[model samples]
Target: MERFQRLDAVAVPIARPNVDTDQITPARFLHKPRSDDHGNYLFHDVRRRPDGTPDPGFVMNRPEYAGAQVIVAERNFACGSSRENAVWALYDHGFRAAIAPSFGDIFAANGLKNGLLPVRLPEDVVAGLIAALEAEPGARVQVDLEAQTVTLPDGSVHPFEIDPFSRHCLLNGVDELDYTGTLAPQIDAFMNRYGRENR
Candidate 1:
């Protein structure tokens, strides 16, 4: 997992609500192995036209939002299904953070484990962000995990909260297994003490 300390990068606005896991990455593409670059399949169906050509009108297809690392979106982003692939698709597609009013519980969890930062803010705040991104295409936003704050394009800062453990893990670029590995010495000592007492 990648460490997320501070990010200052281009942002893309996705104004719709209730964007589901299937919409992020269609179920048909699930058969592909994890080694494959899922980036190509991110928003696979919606970003294309009925004839399977790239839809120029889609925000992602537009040149201005190209290489956007942050997504400012409406409420309930990634709301359907418990598929972890949704997070994978977003991460592989180069998105490091998603800002919204709310997120699906499972998707948020998956995002943290996979190194995608999911930010929850007031609806009005998110709307403001979306408006700014739209008004000025290719605008950049800042996310500082250490401060738990997001800086908008116009220089306003909004704070957010995350589970302490998740924040710690993300800051250090460690997964659950990697964190547990750090406690090996303590675990060994406890096991030795228990064996002596039992015997």
Candidate 2:
């Protein structure tokens, strides 16, 4: 997982609500392998047409929003059945964070565990941010994970909260195993003591 401290990119807006995991990556593609190439399949259904040509109408296909690293969205982003692949698709697509008013609890957890940051702000605040991104999709926005702040193109800032454990893990580039590895010594010592007592 990438250790994310700061990111600057053109933020893209998905102004609709209740964007589910299937929409992020269609169910038909679930059999595919996980790799950097997964990005090509992100939002497959919406990003492509029936003939498999890129849908030029989708925000992702628009020239200005190409390679966007952040998604500014409406409420209930990532709402649907729990699927870690959804997070994988987004990460592989190069989006490191999503700013929305709310998220599906399971999707948020899956995303955070995979080093994707999900930011929650008031509905009104998110709406304003979406408007800005829509008005100028190529304008850069700064996401400072260490500061827990998002700096808009015009220089305004909005703070967001993250779980302390998640923040710690992201800052250090440690996933669940890496975190458990930090306690290896303690676990070994406790096991040694148990062996001594049992003997």
Candidate 3:
């Protein structure tokens, strides 16, 4: 996973609430292997019209929000199903972080494991950010994981909290399994000492 110490990129706003995993990546597309570009299926059903063409009405389809690396969303974002594919779709689609009033528990966990930061803030604060992004479609928001703060387009900075271990892993570019592997020397030493003492 790539390190996520800081990000300064365009943020796309999704004003809807309860955007479930199914919407993020339709279940039918889940059969594709991870090696495939899952980003192509991100919001597949919603991003396209019934005729199969890209929907110009969707926020993500807007030309200005192209290549946005951040998502500002309403409450209960990514709710429903414990599919890690939801995180994959977001990360694969170039989003490194998401800011919202709240998020589905499993989605948040999956995000940390995949190098995507899920930031929780007050409802009003998130609303303000979403409003700002909607008003200025191509505006950039700054995220500093080391500082645990997000700088809005209006130049206002808001603090957020994250699990200490998650923060450490993100800053160091290691997943939980990679982090555990780093403790091999200590684990070996402890095992050797225990064997000698017990013998």
Candidate 4:
């Protein structure tokens, strides 16, 4: 997991709500070998037309938003069954943070575990940010995880909320289990001291 102290990147605005996991990465691609580059299948269904050509209508297909690292969306983003792979596909596609009004609980968790910052701001704030990014696709937004703020194009700032521990993990580039693994030495010491006495 990469540390996410702060990021300044061009933003891609996907102005839809309730974008579920299936839409993010269709179920068919779920069983593919992990080494097969899941990023290729990110938003496969939405990004491709029926005849297999790329959908030019999708926000990501636009050339201006190419190499954008931030995703701004509407309410209830990534609402679907708990599949960590959805987060993987987005991460593999180089999205470091997602800003929205709300997100599916499980998806948010998955995102944090994978070092993706899910910023939850108020509805109006998100709407304004998305509107600005959509209108100015070449513009960049600054996301400061340490400050818990999103700096918009107009030089204004909006604050967002995140779990403190999750923020710590992201800043330190550690996953949940990786954090626990850091305590191994203490665990070994405790076991050696207590086990000898118990015997």
Candidate 5:
């Protein structure tokens, strides 16, 4: 996992709501064992037509939003079943942060563990971000995890709250797996004490 301190980059607007985990990566791409190259399969269904041609109208296919590092979307982003692959796809596609009015609890947790910042803001603020991106293509937005603030294109800022543990992990590039590994020393000590008592 990569440390996420501050990010300033162009934000791609995904206006749709109720975007589920399957839609982010699709079931067909789940066969691959490697996380690499999943970016090409991100939004596979929406980005391709029946004949497998690129859908020109899709926000991701648009030239201006190509390589965007942040995504501004509507409410209920990343809903449905809990799949960690969705976070992988987004991160692989260069999207490090997602701003939405609401998100699936499991998806948000998965994202945090994978170094993707899931930002919760008022619906109006989310709408404003979408409008800004639509009106000005390639508009840059700044996300500072340390400050818990998002700076819009026009220089306005909105604050968001994040769990302290999640924030600490993301800042230090430590995932849940890393946290578990950090407890190995204590676990070893406990095991040694238990063995002596049993003997």
Candidate 6:
């Protein structure tokens, strides 16, 4: 997992709500090897037409936001099934963070484990961000995890809420397993004392 202190990147506005995991990475693409190259399959159905050609109308197909690393989406984003691959697809596609009004509970947990920042903000704030990004294509949004704020293009900042433990994990690039491993010394000490008494 990579440390995520702050990020300033091109924002891709996905205006849809309830974008489930199946839509993110279709079940067909799930059979492929579990690697970090799922970017090629991100939004597979939306990005490709029936003829297997690029669909020019898709937001990701637009050349300007092709390499966008941040996604601004509507409410209830990442809702529905809880497939970890969905999070992998987003990360593989270079999206380090997603801003929305809410997210599926399971999806949010999966995202945090995989180093994706699923930011929850007010509905109006999310709508404003979408509108701003649409109006100014290729505009960058800065997300500062350390400061717990989202900096808009106009120099305005919006504060957000994140669990303290999750925040710590993201800041240090540590996953749940890594966090547990941090207590190795205490575990070893307890085991040693118990073993001596058992003898």
Q: List the residue pairs that clash in candidate 1.
A: none
lDDT string, candidate 2, 75-171, tens digits: 9999997878888899998999998999999999998888899999899988988888889778888988899999988899999999988998898
Tens digit of per-residue lDDT, candidate 4, span 84-157? 88988988998999988999999999999897889998998889988888888878999999999999999999
Winner by TM-score: 3
Query: TM-score of every model?
Result: 0.90, 0.88, 0.90, 0.89, 0.89, 0.89
Candidate 1 TM-score, C-alpha based: 0.90
lDDT of 6 by residue, 151-196 (tens): 9877789999999999999999877886678999999999999999
Task: Estimate, for each residue in 1-199, the C-alpha lDDT of model 5 and write its tens digit.
Answer: 7999999999999998998889998887777766467788789899999899999989878888877999888999999878788888888889999999999999999989888999999999999889989999899999999999999999999999999999999999877776788899999999999999998
Query: Which wins on TM-score, candidate 2 or candidate 3?
Result: 3
Model 2: number of backbone collisions = 0
Clash pairs for candidate 5: none
In model 2, what are the clashing residue pairs, if there are any?
none
Worst 10 residues of 6 by lDDT: 27-36
Which lDDT values do the candidates have, in the order given? 0.94, 0.89, 0.94, 0.90, 0.91, 0.88
Give me the displacement of residue 24 in model 4, in angstroms.
0.3
Give the residue spans of candidate 5 off by over 4 A: 181-199
Query: Which regions in candidate 6 have their CA more than 4 angstroms from the true location?
Result: 181-199
Better of 1 and 4 by lDDT: 1
lDDT of 1 by residue, 16-106 (tens): 9999999999999888889989998899998999899999888988788989999878999999899888888999999999999999999
**If both were scored by lDDT, which would come out higher, candidate 1 or candidate 2?**
1
